[model samples]
Target: MLPLTLRFSLLALSCMLPLAALAETPLSTERVTELETLLYQDCGSCHGMTLRGGLGPALPESRMNAYSRDGLAALILDGVKGTAMPGWDGLLTEQEARWIADHLQNDNPLDE
Candidate 1:
């Protein structure tokens, strides 16, 4: 069995490896700002200003925990067919979509 420190290090690396692979190019401050606004003003229209619940379902951790980050990103970029959600694939990269997926579940600060 590995020591706790070694195990923790491996676990952290495992978790990060996928994201590191997914997002090769870091989001610039301008792009990040644009996405932030879309997330709030656009997505918020349905997901709720506080991401609680509205025309769309609530996006709290409890709800988001049901899906993996990759799955969530796909859903965001590809959109849910037969639903109100429209695909953003033409407008956003997979990396940006993945960033949004991770952000939504993590309660990222909107002010930055």
Candidate 2:
């Protein structure tokens, strides 16, 4: 049988694992600002700087609200097939992607 101390340590670790999995690194103020810029500038390059539609369709708030937050994050990370949209997974964490998705859905500038 394991020693009492070892058993206690294992129990503590098991309890903490779930909490760790649930915890995402919160975005800093600077990171949020950077993401906003990326959304308008980088994504805007195709979607339009104002998201009024350029090479891509306009990202009206009504349309943005149609997608689930997680679904939108996945789309941002994975990009659409055969489309100009490129996956940003290489440059962003899942948390960051979620933030961008939430921003687009909740705080989008275009109020169509």
lDDT scores of the candidates, listed in order = 0.82, 0.93
lDDT of 2 by residue, 9-76 (tens): 99999999999999987889999999999999999999999999999989988998899999999999
TM-score of 2: 0.83
lDDT of 1 by residue, 1-112 (tens): 9999999999999999999876576899999899888887788899887776688877777666578988999999988999988898998888888878888767644322
Model 2 accuracy (lDDT, Cα): 0.93
Residue 96, model 2, lDDT: 94
TM-score against native, each model = 0.71, 0.83
Candidate 1: lDDT of 2?
Answer: 100
Residue pairs with colliding backbones in model 2 are: none
